[model samples]
Target: MTEENLNTSGNPSIQDVVEQRLSRRGMLRMGVGTAGAAVLGSLSLAACGGGGDDVAAAPAPAPSTTPISLNFPAVAKSTADLVTVPAGYTATVLYALGDPLNAATPDYRNDGTDTNFETRAGDHHDGIDYFGLNAAGTARDVAGSERGILVMNHEALTDQFLHAAGVTANPRPAAEADKEIPAHGVSCVEVRKVNGRFVYQRESQYNRRITPNTPIEMRGPVRGNALLRTKYSPAGTDTRGTINNCGSSVTPWGTFLTGEENWSGYFARSATDDTARGGATAKSVVSLARYGRPQNSASRHGWETAGAADLYARWNISQTGTSTDGTDDYRNEMNTYGYMVEVDAYAPAAAARKRTALGRFAHEMGMFGLAQAGKPLAVYMGDDSRGEYIYKFVSTASWDAADASPANRMAAGDKYLDAGRLYAARFNADGSGQWIELTIANTTIANFANYRFADQADVLVNARLAADAVGATKMDRPEWAAVHPVTGEVYVTLTNNSNRKIEASGSGQQSVDAANPRAYTDAPTAATAPGNVNGHIIRFRETGNEPAATTFAWDVYLFGAEAGMDATRVNLSALTADNDLSSPDGIWFSRKTGLVFVQTDDGAYTDVTNCMMLIGKPGQVGDGAVQALEYTKADGSKLTVNARVGAKPTSATLRRFLVGPKDCEITGITETPDGKAIFVNIQHPGETIAKANIGDATKFLSHWPGNAGYGAGGALARPRSATIVITRNDGGLIGTDGTQVLNGY
Candidate 1:
C-alpha cells in the first residue's frame, strides 16, 4: 500500500505528550503537582534520560528445543528484468493481467485492443488468498492442494498500457471507460496442477469477477441510514461497487475480506458543492472535506467526463439533484465506499457485503486474531495514510468452533461481523498502549467540537473524527498486519512517512516520538523524506494473552535501513547485508512453518536494490530493550526519547528470499495446505514509462514477464502485472528442508 498524505487532523503528537509527562515527573519529585500523581500511575516511566544513547539490558531469551532453519541459500539482490529466487527454486508465471476467465473470451493481444474486460483478469494484482477445492473440484476441501481458487484484488490501473494508443484526452470515450471501470475490483479464478506446474482453469465454473459496477449489500449499524441514501439505492440497502481494493484476508467462515483503500481519489466534486449543501457549517460538507474530497477536487482518472449517463455521472459527486433527500443524484455515493467488503469465493451467486461495523477510513486489511471457542473475536486493521490511527473491531458474539465450516458462509459472516465495538489504538511514550473505544457513550465523542453526532451511524461514518476526539496516536502510514501463529501477537507495517519532521512545518506534519522515532535525510542532499525515509515494524502482545484485552505491551520489532548506515541511530535492529530492507508493506506468517515473510513496496532504498521479500525467525515483542535516541530539531536544538527496540536480526534469523522485476511491487503471497508451493504477485512492472512514449516500445522501462517469455512476448511487448508460482526442484516444502519437526508436532 502507498502513502496518500490525506490526514490533516493536527492532533497532538506523542512527542508532545512525552515532553509534558517528563516535566510532570520532575515536579512530582520536588513535592509539586501531587494532585496529578493518581492520573499518571499507570504510565510506564521505565526508562528516561538526557543526552547520548543509553541502552537498556534485555532479559535472556528462552531457548527453543527445535529451532526452525532456512533450507535454501539467500538470493542475491538484482535489478535484472526477471523474478530472482534461490538457486534451487523456480518461479513460473501463472495468471496475468487481461487473461481470459471464460472459455469464450479471446486471449489478450498485448497491443491493448481487447474488450469485454468484465470477464478478463484485472490489472495490478495484489493481496491474494488460496481456497482449497475437493478432489472432484465441486466443493470446499481445506486439505486439497492440487486444485483450488485464487482470489486477489486488482488495486488500480497502469492506464498507459490499457489502451491501443494510450489514454485519450478528457471526455474519455465510452469504450475506454468501459474497460477501465471493471479493472479496479476483485477476481476469483480456479487453478489446478496439470503437469507438475500450476495453471489457471480458464473454463472453470468458479471463475468470477466483481467490479465497480457490481451490486453490493450494506450491512451493520450504518446500513439503511439517511447518509447512505442515494439515487442508486434510495432505501440505503445497496450500492454499486468496490474500488481501490488494496490488501485482503480469508475468514474463519470461508469468506474473503478485502479493504477499500484510496477510494476518495476516484470522485469529482463541483466548486459550489459546499454552498449547495448549506455552506461550510453543514455536517455533510464538513464530513466530505475531512475525508479528502473537498469541493472542486478533481477525480484521479476523470471518469466523470465520459458522458451524462448514470454510468459516468455517478463518479461526479456534486449535489445536482432536485430532491432534498438526494434521490435523483449521486450526492451520497462517496459514503458507500471506504469499507471492508466480504466475498464468498465458493458461492458464485452471492453478492459481496460491506461490513459497516468496521468504521470507514483508508482501510488496509482486516486480519483476525487467534479464535477461541467461547471468546469474542478480534480483527486488527490499519488505515493507510500518513498520521492515521490503527483500529480493532471486537465482535459482539462469541466464537463457535462449528461455525468455521457452516453450511451458509455468508450467514455466518452476519452473525459475527454485523455487530462489533470499534476501538482505535493509542501508543504511549513508554512501552505500553491502550485501545480507545469509538462510541457515542464516550463523552469526548458525544461532545466533539468539529462535527455533531446524530447517532451510532454518524459516529461510524465519520470514524476519523471520533478517533481524533479521543486522541488516538497517529502512526507512520500503517499498512498490512499479520498475527503470529504461535504467540497470537499482532505486527503492523508502518510503511514510511514523508510528511514527518523534527518539528511541525504545518497542520499535517508531525515530529519524532518513541514509537516513530527517526528523522534524517536519506543522503546529505537526497530529495527523499527527511524523517523516517525507511520505515519500521511494531509488534505488541495483548494483555493476559487474550484477544479482547483493552491494553497491551509493545516494542519496535525492526527498523528498515541500509546495512552500512549508522549503527546506534538508523540501523537500530543491527540488520546485516543478507537481510536489510526498506518500506515493509505486505507481511504474513506461514501457519505450518512459523516463519514471517516481509515484502517491500519502496522507492527509498531502490538505488541499491529493487523491492524484495525476506524470511525471518521472529521473536517476542520484548525480546530487546529500551534505547534513548537523540535528534536535532528544526532550530538545531537537541532532543531525545527512550524507544523500546527489538533484538538484533542475524543472518540465521533473517535472509532475503526473492527480488521482483523492474518497477514492480512484490505483494500478496499464499501457499497450499502442505506448504510445498507459494504464489506471489508482481504488480505494475514497467509502470513508469511516459504516457507519450506508449507507442514506442524501445522507450519502455521494462517488458517483464513478456521479455521472460510468459505471455505475448518479444522486444516490443508491453509489461503486465502477473502471479507466479514458486516451488522447490526436489518437490519439498517451500522454505524448509522438510525434515524439521515443529514445536508441538
Candidate 2:
C-alpha cells in the first residue's frame, strides 16, 4: 500500500485485543531478557568503553565493542539531478528499467510504447543478490563475486512509463494490465568485471526473468493447508509467480530469497462480503482487514476487473465461494502470497518455491544470522508495516559446513528453511530484549479469542495473529536488518512512523519508548509527524554472542538528521552536512572490511537533499551510555526517555558516498569479495511527479539515467530505475579502513 494511505500503526480493529494481552506476557519477556542481557553484558563489557559519551541528552552509556574507525573526507550535499560521488570514485549505469535481457527483444523506446515485457527487464528495481556462477552456468564453489549471476527484484511499476497514457481508469482495460503483469517479479542476469568495471552480459545463458505469470511450488508447514486452497490450486500445493518482490536476502546454500511486500494492495474484494454471511464469516473479514484488505478494497490497479477466467478472477480475493470448504472460489488466494520465495540462479529453468514456514506478514527481507559449524541456525525477518514486529526463525537442524557445498541448493534449503521455529522480538524499556516464540504451544496463543488456530500450520499461516497473541513490541516500520560481520551485532532499521502517539479512544497504539524513541516532523512536506522521521538504527548482540540465543542487549546506534538542525529539537546525532541523512532503509556490512553501508528512501528530507547512500565504521556495543531524549507526546505531555545510545558519528567516521537523482531511492547495495567493485540500485526516479502532466516531456519530473550523467546513450525521454556500479578511479579497494586509501585489497 502507498504510504499516503497505509495504516502504518497497524489495524485499529485489533488494537484493543493486542493491548489487553501485553501485560499478560510480561513474565515471559523478563525471563527471556534477563538471561540474554547477562550473556551479552559479560561478552561486551570488556570490549566496549566506559560510559563517556559527552553528547547532551544522550542515552546512558554501557560497555561498547570498539569498531574499526573510518578516515575519508565526506561528500558535500547536492540537488544536482545526478549521482554525486567522491573524487576517487566513478559510477557506471549497468542495467536499467525496460532494458532488454535478450538479443531477440528490441531496445527500450523510453516513451512507453515498448511491449513484450517478459523478454525485457522490469521497472522499480529493489533488493539484489549476486551468486558466483561459473562459465558453464553452474554455481561457483568459492565466493567469486567478481563474475556472477545477479538476481534483483522488480518491486513496483510507474504506470505512466509503462502504459502509453498511464494506467486506465474506471472500467479498467485488461490490455493495459496485461503488460503490467510480467513487469512485477525478479530478474536474473549474468555480470562480470572487466578492467575494474562491472557490466551486465546481455543474452547470457544465466539471463532469466520470473514474472507474475510464471509457475511456482509451495513447501513447508502450510503447503497443503485448508487456508491456502483456491480454484486454481485446489490441492493448495502450488501457485503462480511471486509479486511485489522487495528487499531480499541470500541463503548460505546459494539461492535468492525474495520477499512479497505490499501484496495486500494487489487483491480486490467485494463491498458487502463482510456482511454477506450475517457475521458468520466475521473471522475471515478480520484476517483480511489485518492485512489491509477489507471489504470493497479496490486494489492498486483493479486487475480483477480485467476478465472472469481464473487468470484474472484470482486477483479478486472475495468470498464468493460455492462450497463450504472455499475450494471452488478464490477466497483464500491471498494466503498464497506473503511468503519468501526461493529462486536458484544457477538453475534458471527450475520453478521457484515458497518457503511458508518462515511465516507470513508484510515481509521485507530474511537475513540469516551468523552461521557456525555445529550450531543451530537462525534467519531474521522484518514486517515492513509500521507498528509491526521483527521475527527470527531457528532451524530444527544444526549447521553443517558441508551443507553449503551442496550441488542442489534448493534441496539444501529444505533441510534448513522448511522446518523452523519462528520468534517475534519484544524490546523492553530497559537495555535488554527478548525473542518470544510464536508457536501454538503457548497457552495465550492456543486460547486466543480472536481466531481459532487448529495446528502449528494454522498458526504459521496466520503469523500476524500469533504475534498479536504473544504481545510483540510494535515497531516503527522495520525495513531491512543486517548482522555485523566481525562483532556479531544485529542492526535493524526502523524507517519512521507517523502514528507513534496518535491513538483513537479505546485503541491500543503504542507511545514512544526507549526502543523507538524519537517523534519528529518534516515541516516542508508533512506539517507534523508523531514518530521518528529521520529514522534511527538500533543494534543488539545475542546472549553469549550466539545467533540462536533468545536474549540480547540492544541500543540505538545513530539517529538521522539534516544539517544545521537544532540538537535540542532532536537532531540527536549532532549531524553535519557530510554525514546527515533521513529514513535509513537499506544497510549492509562487509565482514572482510568491517564497514557498514547505509542507504536512504526518504520523504522527509527530500527538500534538503535527494536520497543517497553513506558509509560508516561498524563499532562495538556499550561504546556510549544512556541518553536523555526530550520530546512532546501526542497528548502534549513533555516526555524524556532514558534510552541507550552508542558511539557518535563524526565527519571522519560517517560520510556520504553517493546521491541519486530527483525522486529516486538509494537501495540494494552489494560488493565483490575483494571489495574493489560495488553495486547500488537507483529505484523509481521521478516517482512523486503527477502522472497527468507527464505527456509534456519537458514537464516530466526527471530525465534520469540519461540526465544523471549515464553516458551509455539510451533515449533521454523519461527517468528509469537502474543499477549502477562504483569503482575507485585509482583501482584501489573502495573506501578501505583508515590509512589504507592507496592499498589494494
Candidate 3:
C-alpha cells in the first residue's frame, strides 16, 4: 500500500473544541520603540534579540526617524506549507519540536518513543525573547546580542503525533501521559551565529526545559491566599509549573513573562458538582460557564483517569471534595494557574514565578511601557477568548534606573509585579477608553450578585466577574498585543469571534459595537457562526500618548481579510495580493527598523494562503476619521455607533514577508540587535492529520522544515513545530531604507 493508503483516517481528529489547542512597535524592542519624539515602553536591553549600535555602552540620544529600506522584493503568496522569505534572505530551522538540547538526551527518533521530555524541547513554539548572556553565561549581557539565549514558550502539543497509539483513545496510556506532561511549557536554549549561519548549542549550561512538573513560586495579590490553597500546596504560595504559555514578553528587569492561556480547559469537573462543595460557591458555576468550563465538561484529554495516582489526576480542576476549605481537595487547584509566569532567562536554574497580582484570566501576553527615570511602570495585557477583556497593571512604585539591569532580576520583579493595580479596559463608542480598576473598592464588584468581592485577592481571582460588572468592552478573542515604537500607542489584534450575533432579547449574543464592529459572513467557520471571520487590528494611545495615562483613544488599525473580500465589509483595510491576512495573532514593532510585523493564526482564509506574516509601517492612533456603524438591536431596531476607524492600507504601507506550512500559525518574531537576523516560529504544521495516520510520517499532512530542506536527507519528515532564523545574504541589516519605516519598497 502507498504511504497514504495504509492510514485511512487522514482528517484531523479534533477534540471537544480541539481541547484546545492553543514588537514592538518600533521603539527598538517590541515595546522599546520610540513613540513620537520620545521613546515609548521597552523591554530590557538585555531582553530578546535585536541590539546593535552599543547604545547602552555609550548612551546617546535617540536615532533620527530615518525610514529603513528593504533591499529585497516582496515574495508572492504561496499555497505550499513552507517558510517563504523575501528575496536575498535565507530561512534556516534552529530548533524543532522534539529536538534535543542537553548532551545526555539522545536525538529524537520520530517514533514517539522519546522519553525524558522535561530535558528536551517542548511542542508548539510560541512567543519568544532573546537575552544576551555574558561570556561567562551567568548574567544578562546587554552589550552583546549576537550570542544570547533564546527563551521560547511551547504553547501546546499535537497529541496524536506525539504518541505511537494516538491520544484520542479514551483512557490515556501511562507512557502517553508522561510524554504529554513534559510537552507543554517553555524552553531556554543558547543560540549563536557561526562563520555565516546561526546554530543552536546542543549542550549549554543555560539550556533548560520548564515543563508542567516544574515548581513555580506564586506571588502578588493572590499569593498566600486561602482560595488558592490546594492539596498540593496548602500554603497557596506556589503551584506546579505553567501551561498554555502562548504570547510572552520580557520584563525590563531581564525576566521572561509567559502568559498561561486556555488553562481552564485542561481541568475536568462533574456534572453534579455545581452545588456548594469544598470552597466553591454559586459564583463558581457562573464563572465556570462564562469561561467556557461549565460543569460536566470533559477534561482536555481525560488525564485524570489516565492512572490511579494524582500525577495525572491533579489536572482535574473540578470541585472534588465537600470539605469546608480547599486544602483537602483539588477544587481550587486550577485557580492557582491562569496567570503570567516570570522566568529569569539569564539564570536558567532560577525558580519561575506566577505573578497573580496581575489578575487571573486567560492571559494572552504582557507588554511594558518604557521604564522611565521617575515615571510609573505600565504593563498591558489581553484575555484570549471570546467576549474577553483587555487589561493593564500599573506598578505603584516609581521607576529607577538602578532597577533596569538589576543585580537580582527576580527581586526587581518583586517590587513591580507584586504591588500593582490590575485594571480592566472599557472601550467607549466615542473613540475614547478607560482603564477600570479591578479592585474590591469598586462598588459595581464589591456587591456583585454573581460573585462577591470579599478582598483584593477575591477581586483578582474572579476578575472576569468584575470585568462584566464594570461593563468592560467585550472583545473578539484578544490574542497578542503590541505597542508602537514611536507613537506610544498600544495595538491589540482582535482575532475573529464566531459566537457574535445580532442583538436579540433571547438570542444571548455579542452584538456589534465600536470596538468589535464587524458582523458579516464572508467565509464562516460554521453555518451558525458568522460574525467577525477575518479579524481586525485595533490601536490605541493613552490620553497623553503615555502609558502612564489611564484614559486613551482607540481605532481599528487594519482589518484582516482575503485579497478580494468586500471592501465595504470584511476587507476594510483594502488589502491587496501583497498584504492580506485573517485572525492576526502575533504582532510586534521593530524599533530597530521602524517596521511593524503582523502574523496570522487563522483557518478563516487558509484556502487562499497558509497562515503568514506581513510587514508594514503603522500610523499612530486617530490617523483615520471616525466611522458611524449601524447595528441591528434586539427589537430589530437600528443602533448606530461612532468609531475611530483606520484608513485602508495601500501596497506601499504593507506587504507580506513570509508564509508557513499547512495547518500552522506563523508566530514568535524577534530580530538580532543589529537587525541583521530575524527569528520566527512555525506551530503545529500537520495538525489536520488524524490520530491513526499521525504515526505514518509519510502520510502526515505536512513535511515542514524537513521537506523544506532543514531536516535529514531522504528521511520521512515527521511534522514538528519549530523556530527558524532569517538573515540577509548581502550581509547588510535585514531591511530597506529611507527613515527606518518599512513603508515603501
TM-score of 3: 0.90
The alpha-carbon RMSD values of the candidates against the true structure, listed in the order shown, are 10.0, 8.9, 7.7
Ranking by TM-score: 1, 3, 2
- Model 3 stretches astray by more than 4 angstroms: 1-66, 135-138, 276-281, 504-508, 524-529, 630-643, 712-715, 739-745
Output the number of the TM-score-best candidate.
1
For every model shown, the clashing-pair count is 0, 20, 48
Give residue 43's lDDT in candidate 3 (0 to 100): 29
Question: What tens-digit string does per-residue lDDT give for candidate 2 at 1-745?
Answer: 2232233323321111211222122112111001111122233211110000000111222322223345356777777678888887888899898888889998787777788888788988888876665545555633465687778999888777786677667556777777888888999988987776688888888899998889899999999998888888889998888898878777766678888888888888888878763453566776787788878888887878887767788888887876776788888888998898898888878889999999998888887766655666778888888778889888888777666557787898888889989998888777788888988899988998877788898888778888888878787788888875434578888787765553323343456777877665667645754556677888888877776799988888888878676675567777788899988898876433446888999988887788988988655666667778776545787777776777777776788888888888888876655556777899998876566876766776667897755533243558888888888887666775332210111
Against the true structure, candidate 1 has what lDDT? 0.82
Model 1's TM-score against the true structure: 0.92
Per-candidate TM equals 0.92, 0.89, 0.90
Question: Where is model 1 more than 4 Å wrong at Cα?
Answer: 1-3, 15-65, 524-529, 738-745
**lDDT tens string, model 1, 405-464?**
779989988998999899999999888999999999998899999989889899988899
Candidate 2 global TM-score: 0.89
CA lDDT, every model vs. true structure: 0.82, 0.73, 0.73
